[model samples]
Every structure is written in C-alpha cells, then in structure tokens.
Target: MNAECGICYEEYDWKERIPCIGICGHTICDRCRISMTSKKCPHCVRPDAFKDKNVNKQLWDLIRFTQLVFRKHSFQEEEFSEDTKRCSHCSEPSNKLRVCYDCCIQNGLVHKYMQEAEQKEENIETVLQNIRDQALCGDCVIDGVHFQHKTEYVDSFIESYSRFLNNRN
Candidate 1:
C-alpha cells in the first residue's frame, strides 16, 4: 500500500510516475501501464480490462501523506544500496556502480577525438561501438542524453523518492 507500483516495483511520483487503476481494481505505475501488452490488467489477466484505466488518486494522496509523515518524524538519513540508486541516463539501476559518461569522456575512457570526416560519416553502429568501447553505463546508446545537453543527472522524482526511503531511519 506504499507508493510503489506492483508491476514494475518502482516508486510512484506526482508527475510521470503516477499510478493507474485498472478495471479489476489493481494498481500499476504509469511506466508499466505504457508497456502493457494488450490493454489487459496484468494482475487479473483480464483482456482489455485496463482499456479505461483511471488515475489512482487515493493512492497518490496516501503517498503524499506518507511523505509528510516521514518528514514530520525527522527520520535519519540512510546509506543506499546500489540497487536502489538509479542511473543518470536510463533512470534504471541496471548497473549500480557505473561511472558517469562525462567523467569517462574527461578521463579518456573513449577516443579523445575523431576525424571530422569520420565523425560526419559515422553510422549508428559506429556510435554504438564507441559507446561500448567507452564502457559507459546506463544504456547510453538507447537512453542517454548528450553530456553537453544534460542539465540534471538524476530524475527529480526518483531523487526525492530515494531521499524519502533513506530518511525512514
């Protein structure tokens, strides 16, 4: 009954992480909702049951209340395990200990420079190969924002949720 989604087991947020309730009354996070296979409630296995899903406002309110309670209790900060922390790119903790791409680039983990002709002529495969060669974590090929374009390393909602969990002590 906490803020986590039963499907993906990720924490809910007020923005994109909002929870949705299926016709069968099972709640899932928006991420899972978007990835659903057949508009069916995964929990109930009812085909098309989730065609008209609604936002679980009550659960969202409960999450807010819980956040307020935790803040009121003055919970102590706790250390986070690698699994609980998210990657700056994909926002998933697939690899908990990977270094940021900016650091890698600065440290010469990848080629410092490519020829202008090569850079202009490079294909997607070449880019992917470079990303792999750099050994950057967080699915850079698929989900990474260019380092120059990155304003925030972590998702704000996930960061807040991590704080909430860590302060439970």
Candidate 2:
C-alpha cells in the first residue's frame, strides 16, 4: 500500500516516500515524518520510554542523515541537539537556545562558551579598571543579544551601570 503524509494528508507513492514506524505502529512517510521533532510518535504521544540497541543505532543514523538533508535545504540553519540544557553550554533551555551544530563547529560556539566561564574570573584589577573607564565590568555577564532585547537583568543593567557590576559580584 502507498503511504500518506500524516500532516498534509497528501497521497504518497511508496517509491517516492520512505516508511518509518513509531512504537505505536503508526506508519509515516519518512520524508514527512514527525520524528525530526520528537522521538515519540506525534499521534500516539507515547513517552517512547525505551529502545533496543538496533533502534538506538537507527535513530542516530536517522538524525545524522536528517541533519545533512536539512543542511542542504538551508533549514539546517539551526541544529537539533539532544542536549536538554536550556543553554546547552549555559543554563539556557535547549528549546529556547538553538545553535546550528554545523555553524557551531565551524564558528566554535562550543569553545566560545567554554572560554566564557573563564571570563567570569577576571581579576579585581581588570574589573576595577573597566568600571573606572565607564565600561561594562570585567566580570559582568552582560553579553549577547539578550541584553539588547531587554532580557532578565538587562533591564536593570540599563537602569544603573553599578547594578550590572553589583550583580556580577
């Protein structure tokens, strides 16, 4: 039997589409499968609690191939990582924090965040110097586009430069 698109309900020829079965046995066309957004079948909402070794390996292969396919399509501008941490490297939620694994590898976001930790340890001399020069305190965490967008402490930072320094301490 031919498969159908689960989302658009369009007819799909088996030759033109691939088959993927979730644990619930809901078969979906691989070309339009919801697996990219989730491990559980979107229809069943099962936790997908466990997986055998074979399934795990297949999943990894799927992820890599999908990432590559997405890259080719320019939709791969952002990466899909299993890293659940908000910030992955920071505390940012993975849902809120998106990084293109391809770009990150090329541009070194992983290394950059690693270096950011050391940035907080800037000596008192540097901190004082920056503050004296009417600049962001050396230890200040006020970096990234979030500051300009008025996130969290950024509003308060705009209120008082001293507040930025005090918070870093």
Candidate 3:
C-alpha cells in the first residue's frame, strides 16, 4: 500500500487526502492532481492517461481507518482543546495565529504581483522572492504559489532555494 503522496511526499491524511488513479495505474495526491497542467501520467509520462474517473475509495477507506486508529492512540487521553483563532481565508479556527495565503489571494495581492512579474518577465527566483517578502506568514508562501499561473516555475524556485539552504548548513 502507498503510504505517502508521490508529488508532495506528505503522509495521506483522512481529510485532505484524495487519491486519484491514472490510466497508467499510478496514484497521485489531490494537490498535485489539481496543479497538473497536462493530462499525462506524471509517473509513466503517458499522454492523456488520467481521466476524471472514480476516486480510489479503497485507498480513502484505508486512510480513514488509519486515522481512526492513530487518533485513538494519540489523542484519546488528551483533552480536546479547540482553537479559538480563525483563518483569514476560510474563517476556520487556524489553531495557530498566522496569515492566510488564500486570504492574500482573495484580496488580490498575489494576482497583482503575478501580473506585474509576467509583464516584466522577472526571473522565477525574483518573483518568488517578491512574494516571500510580502508574505504575512509561512502559509502565504506555501499555499499562495499553487494558485498562480507560474506555479511550476515558483515550485522549482522553492526547491532550488531549499537545496541551497540545505547545502549551506
């Protein structure tokens, strides 16, 4: 059984996890599926392989079962504390106080910057840096890029930056 998402490498959670199976019989996470520009299978590189077919219910069931078991083991003895703080975008309790990237996007700052950057033909690094500078919180940087037209370029820039930082350490 697949334990983590191939694209983001994040462990599948019961809530946000939507496993999509490509026609080539490969699975990808929901985020990557949504962000994908081409309908090709990312793993097999097959053209027009992924279709809007049925979701992998078995995978989802497994994730839910794992979540239930884990929750029982991890949080059963702990007090259920609710976060009073709310997200700026969805207005859901954020649990931690932070700027919401979705909110920033909804407010038009991200779009404005993206438009200006495209017009200027700014380098990907420069565009990402500009966004980072204006970001009110880490989530703003993490989630905002997914909504941009230059998502792939920005993602590449972030990966490169992460590698640079890791090498420096």
Candidate 4:
C-alpha cells in the first residue's frame, strides 16, 4: 500500500488528509484532490482521472494501520532511549520536534494583528541575510525554478563582472 501521497509527499492521515484513488488508479491525498485545478491526475497526468472520484477508504485504512504500527514501534524504541536531549517545543524525549513541518510553518506565520502590535519597520538587511542563509543551506532549497533562477542570475553577474575587468585592463 502506498503510505504517502505522491503529489504532496505527506503521509495519509486517517482524518482530513485521507488517501484517494483516481479513476486512473493513481493515489493522491484528499487535500491535493480538493485543490486540483485540472481534471488530470498529477502523477500519471491522465485527463479526467480524478473527476467524480472519492476517497479510497479501504486503501486508507490499510495505510492508517501501518502508520499506527510504526508509531507504536517508534514509541517503544523511545522508551528504551538513553538520550538526554528533549524537544524544545514539546519537551518530548527526542532531538527533533514532534510537530510536523507544515504545522511549524503555520504556527510561525505572523498575523496582521501581531504585526500591528509590534509596529516595527521591516529590517531589509536582516530579511536579506535570512534569505541568503536559507539559500546557501542545501536542505532549505524548495523549488527547481528558484534554484535555476538564482543560478542564472549569478552566472550573468559573473559574466558582466569579467567583461568589466577585461575592459579596464
């Protein structure tokens, strides 16, 4: 059974993020299914594949059972763990936080009311520095397009600088 959604790469949760099978026999998450702008399956790109399809409950139950077993096993291992490190957010006995990446991002978002409470001007330098740090960190790069754009920009800048140096000499 496919434990994760191919499109979003998120584990199929028994709740809202349930697994669904398209008419083309490709599995996707419910959220992705709902947000689908096109009638085609993202995986196989089959036209009208997801049209009038519902969540595959039988498949989802199997995936859910597997996830439960894995989590139980992980907890059992954690019980025998000797590591002293605890998660900062949850105080869980682990090096990593228990919160999911999406939750962390959502929680980190600054609302308009919070921004108004601070009433501070945007620090461009700090923002730029943060972006630079994220871009240089290989793990933080999200999109191929973003990487390509940055690469092309840097290449163009280098070429221009080389030309300027040659003209000066």
Per-candidate Cα RMSD to the true structure, in Å, reads: 17.4, 15.7, 18.4, 18.3
Model 1 lDDT tens row, 1-169: 3568887787776556678988888888777888877898888898777687589988877765665556431111123343454444433333322444454446543333455453343344444344433333345533554444322233342354335334333
Q: What's the true lDDT of residue 42 in model 3?
A: 86
Best by lDDT: 1
Local distance difference test, each candidate: 0.55, 0.39, 0.51, 0.51
Model 1 regions lying over 4 Å from their true place:
72-169
The model with the greater lDDT, 2 or 4, is: 4
Q: After superposition, how far is residue 117 of candidate 3 from its true place, in Å?
A: 84
Model 4 TM-score, all chains together: 0.38
Model 4: which residue pairs collide? Answer: none
Cα shift from native, residue 154, model 4 (Å): 67
lDDT of 4 by residue, 1-169 (tens): 4477888888676555677888888888888888999969997899988886688888856654664555433222334367433333223343221222232234432121333355445454453333222222222222322333232122243344335334332
| Model 2 poorest 10 in a row by lDDT | 132-141
Among all windows of 10 consecutive residues in model 4, the one with the lowest summed lDDT is 132-141
Backbone collision tally, model 2: 5
**Model 3: how large is the Cα RMSD against the reference?**
18.4
* TM-score of every candidate: 0.40, 0.24, 0.37, 0.38
